[model samples]
Target: MRILIVGGGVLGTLHAWQAVERGHDVVQLESEPEARGASVRNFGLVWVGGRATGAELDTALRARVLWERIGERVPGLGFRANGSLTVVRTEAELAVAAEVAAGAEAADRGYKLLDVAETKKLNPALRGDFRSALWCERDAAVEPRVAQPALRAELARSGRYTWKPGREVRHLSATGVVDDRGERHDGDVVVFCTGAWTGGLVRELAGEPPVRKVRLQMAQTEPLGEELTTSVADGDSFRYYPAYRGPALETLEAGQPQSKVAQEHRMQLLLVQRLDGSLTIGDTHEYDQPFAFDVTEDPYEHLAEVAGALLGRPLPRIRRRWAGVYAQTTDTGRIVHRERVADNALLVTGPGGRGMTCSPAIAEDTAEELNL
Candidate 1:
């Protein structure tokens, strides 16, 4: 089978990987010289512990295993099983963590309620005051910036994968697609993994998928000057992840209101260390359309304050700040929005934040479904 993959982000690259691995010839196209969407702008967290029950959780676990395997094969991925800690500072937050840690799926999720001493011992860099933390051993991280190029390089080894950049697919034809260069690339099957750019060809084919665009703010700071053994999250994260929803969570929310700025911007503090000793920290969620043209300063300030509290020191000077948009299915239960846009072409996207986490499994599923 000759597979034509559109988009050059992680999802598209992974699809190309799956197709090539299955003994199919794949030609992947990208609009930009490189992917500049949410794929590269994310924290590169293969987050698993906070996923909802059922398919969402199952997909994350499968992706985590797949990530480790691929990381071993592709050393440039910079993958590590460092895991994550959602630190709790108050009794309310601790109750929420304790409840989830003792739940039925605790073992599967690697959920353990760690004491202050245990948490500090696990991540020595955390010298701040905190009661306890929810330890998720299943969580992991990868270097997002170089992930796609690294995967593509490995796929090229198969001699069946061809990558075409600086090509914006103009139209989908019966056989394959026609690019802006007026070149026709023929293939047996076409898969559109277009990221957040759903305006032109995407809208013309799928007619507005149930997916919505999400805008987020992120920043990279100067090297922390020390190792952050594990990824860190604030207790506020519990309010955002579906897995943490319970009576205790409800109680915590009612009793402990979020800081004004955090509530206003839908913010959570997730800190991860890059391979270069720098810390990648972010994220405030802005759902409504017409997102701000520029990054807001308040969210970054809030993030710095929370991160400093967790580290017991001032945060390093921020070297860069960025904003990105990703497509997500409005339905919370579904992992992504997939549909057959044409007889020979299928459109798979809207994995949302799961794009970085579950892309491998998602691409694998696409192959199995298409019998590639």
Candidate 2:
């Protein structure tokens, strides 16, 4: 089978990975010389802890396994089983953590309520005043910036994978696609993993998928000169993830509402250290279309204050700040929006923030469904 993937982001790359691994020839096209979507602008967390129970959690766990295997094969991925710690400052937040930790599937989700001492032992960099932390040993991280290129390099070695960058897909057909160069590339199957690009041809074919765009802001800091042994999140993250929903969460929310700035930006503080020792921190969720053209400083300032407090010091100088958008389904229950747009083509997207965490498994399922 000759697979044609229209998009070079992580989702498309993972599809290409699956197709090529299944002995199928794959050709992936990207509009830019490199992908610069939500795929790269993320914490690269193979997050399993906070995934809602059932299919979502299963997918994340499967992806975690696949990520480890892929990371071993692609050293450039920088995959690490560093896990995560969601620090809680108040008893209300602690109650939510305790409930999750005591859930029936807690072990499966790697949920453990950690005391201050235990939390410090896992991530010594956290010297802040926190009552305890929710430890998730199944969580992990990767280098999102280089993951695609690294995967494509490995795919190239397969001798069955071809990557055509700087080629915008202008026309989609049942047989194949026509690029901006007016050249047609034929394939047995076509998959559009177009990320947040929902306009133009995408809307024409899918007629407005049950998905929408989500915008977020992220920043990278200069080298911290210290190892942040585990990824860290503030208790506010409970509001963003689905798994933390329950009576306890409701109580926490009622008792301890988000800060005004946090509420305004729909913010959550997630911090991960890059291979270079720099911290990648982000992010605030903005769902309305026509997102703000400019990134604001208030969110960044709040993130710095929260993260700095956790680290017990001021954050390193921020070197870069940017905003990115990703596709998400209106129905949060769905993992992604996969549909056959044409006889030979399928559109698989809307993994939302889970794109990085579940792409591998999503692609694996795509292969299974397509009988690749």
lDDT of each: 0.95, 0.94
lDDT of 1 at 209: 89
Q: What's each prediction's TM-score? A: 0.99, 0.99
Question: Alpha-carbon error at 167 in model 1, in Å?
Answer: 0.4
Q: Scored by Cα lDDT, where does model 1 land?
A: 0.95
Candidate 1 per-residue lDDT, tens place, 146-223, comes to 999999999999899999999999999998999999999999999999988887898899999899999999999999
Least lDDT summed over 10 consecutive residues: which range in candidate 1?
Answer: 329-338
Q: Model 1, which residues run further than 4 Å from truth?
A: none
